[model samples]
Target: MKSVARKLSAVTLVVIALSNGATAFAQSKVTEIPVPNLVIYPGDLIEEGMLTQQRVLKRSIAGMPIHRHEDAILGKEAKRTLIPGHPIALNATREPLIVRRGTLAKLIFREDGLEIIAVVEPLQSGAVGETVKAKNLDTGLQVVGVVQEDGTLLVEGG
Candidate 1:
């Protein structure tokens, strides 16, 4: 009778353990998600809390299908996804070049139309109609223009 009781308790414990383990495993399954249409390359920013969908790329890392999410991943505070080719720039530096008023400059033709090539010199105190020459950085063409009060050079190039 004693041996029978011990065996029954052991069996009951095993059954309970198995039942709990099965429930946990079911909850841990990866959920199926949809794929996105946009192209996401490495070094692009990503953020969390944004919707994410998978993408079909020509090639994927480790044979895993590519996934894309909306918005850049919020840095450092979110869970990092180990997707290959996704690089985040933390602290970006580099100030934009600004052209001041009364500076001599040149215009160069570009796909976006004429752009300031360079500033020859900034305007001097009480200098009116300062002469400045600028060469197009892209086309190597030279242009001359006078600076205006709005920090823009008016150049007429052929």
Candidate 2:
């Protein structure tokens, strides 16, 4: 009788241990993450109204960089199509481009208290603080410059 009681207690301990492990596994398998409420196409700016939170299985999004909060997605431009009720990938969005291709932008060069400004055509679109290639309209030369906050390209030594 003592042997049977000992076996029953051992089984109970194993059951308790398994239950705890299952609970932990369950908690890790599911999480709440932000998802788009509507289809978001490339170049569309993400807004607060476009996002909603939903519980998602971790395995479904394994190895993907996903946005967990609505704040991370808002005010960003979509780089790829975002499907509704799915995880938003990190590479699927970007900062909105301030300088667009084929647009005229001011090119500013400053050195030793001297500044030269000229009009240039942007060959590529880029956001503030991004390097972009532009054509100097007056000289017809290709130049690379950093996009400034004021929609100007700042070129160094050019």
Candidate 3:
């Protein structure tokens, strides 16, 4: 009878321990966040098809990644390797580069029937539709221009 009582008490303790572990696990909340469906290479522009919503452990979000369905992710370029199933961090993306810094570019200007194109070099990098400063290589003039998709800079107020 003594041995049976001891075994019963041990079983009760084991049951209590199992229940506590289960309760702890159940208390942990799951968070929904955006994750890449495919590997996004560095400098690759993000598209809607490449992302999916996933529910993950709340504690797993250590770096404060971009939340799913919260912001527009398309048209952004990955600054680093983006792995599948991992949340895309806010710092991991940037605007796509249209004009590379220090690269030879053409400066275009148009007014009525007059159109001019000059050889210039960008002083800084910029994305399409963004304005950046370029140096006219021939005349050593600095001019600000809007970057175009074709990698040409259109000088403003021309």
Candidate RMSDs in order: 15.1, 4.3, 7.4
* lDDT tens readout by residue for model 1, 1-158: 99999999999999999999998776554332332223433333433433344433323232443222233233322223333324223222111123543444433223346654453443332122554455544455555555454554566455
Clashing pairs in 1: 35-54, 42-85, 43-87, 46-72, 46-73, 47-72, 47-73, 47-74, 104-132, 106-134
Worst 10-residue stretch by lDDT in candidate 2?
149-158
Q: Which one wins on lDDT?
A: 2
> How well is each residue in 1-158 modelled by candidate 2, as lDDT tens digits?
99999999999999999999999999989988999899999999999889898988888877878887788889999999999998898889999998999989999988777889999999999999999999999999998899988899997772
- Cα lDDT tens digits for candidate 3, 1-158: 99999999999999999999998876666767778999999989888789888888777675665655535678888889999988777788888998989889988987776778999999999999899998999889898999999999986442
lDDT of 1: 0.42
Candidate 3 lowest-lDDT run of ten: 62-71
TM-score between candidate 2 and the true structure: 0.78
Clashing residue pairs in candidate 2 (N, C-alpha, C atoms within 3 angstroms): none
Better of 1 and 3 by lDDT: 3
Worst 10 residues of 1 by lDDT: 88-97
Where is model 3 more than 4 Å wrong at Cα? 1-31, 37-39, 57-67, 111-113
Query: What are the models' TM-scores?
Result: 0.26, 0.78, 0.63
